[model samples]
Target: MNIPNRKTGFFLVITGASFWGVGGTVAQKLFQEYAIDVNWLVTTRLLIAGLLLLTIQFFKKDRSQVLGVWKNWKVAMQLVIFGIFGMLAVQYTYMASINHGNAAVATLLQYLAPAMLIVYLLLRKQTMLTRLDVVTVSLALLGCFFLLTNGSLSQLSVPAPAIVWGILSAVALAFYTLYALPLLKQYDSLVIVGWAMVIGGFALSFIHQPWQVDITNLTVEASLYILFVIVFGTMIAFWFYIESLQSLSPKETSLLGSLEPLAAVLTTVFWLREPFGTIQWIGTACIIGMILILALNKSSSSKTSKSNKKPLRVS
Candidate 1:
């Protein structure tokens, strides 16, 4: 067995999460400044990113897994479901949340996926509750309340549509995380994620043809932002994050992923000048605290989760 290197894993996951964090900020800029629709961006990003990842995998890694995946009908079916309903749904919803709101709020809300997954496992009897779980749940709930309501019982700090979409993003992400497990076990994550993304993009293209967008008015800055989101945020970020599982524990990787929201919050507040008051700060701390606790709890649970055996474990 290849012993996992924590040093490299930490760097990979951190860089991946950082890119994702900044990517959300760029996405917000595209939505707010460029008026790019969430549908088109998600469609194009998924298609391009998936193709890029598959191309890289084909050239550098296992070439057989790329094409061999289609041979199994059951796997293909599952991949389709995972692609359309899981990965695509998460991508679209997260971007939609950013469209409706700012990156800070959208990113924070998506972090709720871990808690949602825990609740799901509880319902499915796959996992039992521990004291740590209870504390984590409490922190998450309290964090969400503060972040959304801003300590006010009557008024919502953020817009209603954003909140709804943000929650939906979390739900979508939870499903994505769970549904990808079987496929990941069968093939490399690059192959499974790459193909799922292609499938999802194709399925969504019928409804919103990303090609229909007018690029004539596209500003140079907007173009750069779009490129960053597709290349760094979606492709490299996902690739490095997934690759880190080769060396890091799922818990450690997830703990490092807390950087995503932190990055989003900082960039949105400082660079974008989106409002984040004291209450919102408290909420951010609570949620990040929850992430930290989750990582700490699982310190000894698994030393190194095999890449083929584990899906991307993000919080």
Candidate 2:
């Protein structure tokens, strides 16, 4: 690996993940201050960001893929499923989580998807559950316990609705990761994800029209933040992370991606003045530690089997 290239990859992935983290916080701010509707935001975000991504693919990648994804019936069905259940579900549940809770908790809860995926694979008999896998799942569950309950089993520190939405977000994320694998393997991620988002956006727009939302009373700062969430947070963040893969291993990229939840936690606590308990912080460490352990294990495994590439795990 080229040293400078690796440095650039690290920078790109961190910046991309940080943007996603801050974007979640920004979305939370909008929900709190302006009472923005989560459905409308999700719709607008998917439409605008999805189009922007496809436009990029058109200019820089194979233009045929921009429309070619719809050519096959089976692939089209997969894309549609991925759009509704995978893309749309993940986005909606995550936004709902932030609406009911702080960005910090929402992001961390979504990270539980990895453990969930492990269990899913184990159940399917696609992969055997090793001791390390058991440890990973245990740590994830324990971390979530402390993060939500502040180490108390009786009550949740966060709102009940927030817990519900956060777990749904994790499930959606796991589905997003697994369901998109076949499509991702066959086509460029940009193509698959772009079209999936477009499909999701169109489906959502029918139920919650974005134009119906009144933005006339919004301040310039609020407008800018909204723009940042769509443009920087969604489009650029995804783009930069994908680009980073050119120079870094998936394992390395996933390891550094831990910064996403960290950034969300820090920004939520300091920037938004959200209260974070010490136990919650400890829980955060535990969750992040699990990510590190998983990534390191993948790195070790990759040495023996170079063909076993992990799928793209965008937030």
Candidate 3:
């Protein structure tokens, strides 16, 4: 198999992020029309995503990789945790945030994943802190603060439960990026995502009990929207995310993924007619700037380290 070029992988990452951003608006619309519960939405989305990926794997590749993953019980257990903590938790928490608060607020809070990733990596002793890292973290936090407060700190008050869920979602997003790094080395990206989604869907189904809901009343638009959530949002986005991790470090991928909220804000404003105040724009700019600084810092450090590996020419 031919390895993908870095540029190709980067393009895939951006495209995946764009789809996720657009997915937010679509979900919001569906929520407004269907009033669907978050739990049901998550369950349906993951189940469909799992089934779709399984179908793809069936036609293109053999079942050997899938069976191999199942044979390793420890790895399989880790994937279950990955599904629960990384996939289902994030989705459920974000939806809970939206239910308790507004879409803008929920999304802004979720964007804290980048800073959370830095803290997690530092705690795990996987990476060291740099001055630029400090600056970037500060900027991202400040950006979220501004966005959440809508430029006024006095008015920045969310429900306690909503805040808890939002923070959890951020943590889950960070965990997903971190866990995906090691898993990508062992299993095919699609295979890993398929199993994770299956596990997550089953878990969410038990909690949601979609069978109790009135499936007969589901409209065509609602069904289509749910399909989009599964196919484009969960499956394809994750595939590209894992692929990008193959070439980029966890921090780099998280930083690049910061574009997701920006894209979400744009899609919301343009398509859904969601209001985007000037303060939101400023906050978005700050977040983008912070991500740029982090990426540049990583790039420069890589170049410097490579240059330092010179052999002495003492003849």
Name the candidate that leads on lDDT: 2
Candidates in order have lDDT scores of 0.84, 0.86, 0.68
What's the C-alpha lDDT at position 177 in model 1? 78
Cα displacement (angstroms), candidate 2, residue 19, comes to 0.6
State the local distance difference test value for candidate 3.
0.68
**Worst 10 contiguous positions by lDDT, candidate 1:** 299-308
RMSD of each: 2.8, 2.3, 7.5
Residue 132's C-alpha lDDT in candidate 1? 68
lDDT of 3 at 144: 74
TM-score of 2: 0.95
Which 10-residue window in model 2 sums to the lowest lDDT?
Answer: 299-308
Model 1 misplaced regions, further than 4 Å: 1-7, 299-309, 313-315
lDDT of 3 by residue, 91-204 (tens): 788877766654555676776776777766667776787776687788888777766666876776456566677778778776676666556567766777777777888998
Model 2 per-residue lDDT at 152: 84
Which has the greatest TM-score? 2
Candidate 3 at residue 121, lDDT?
Answer: 63
Q: State which candidate, 1 or 2, has the greater TM-score.
A: 2
TM-score of each: 0.93, 0.95, 0.81
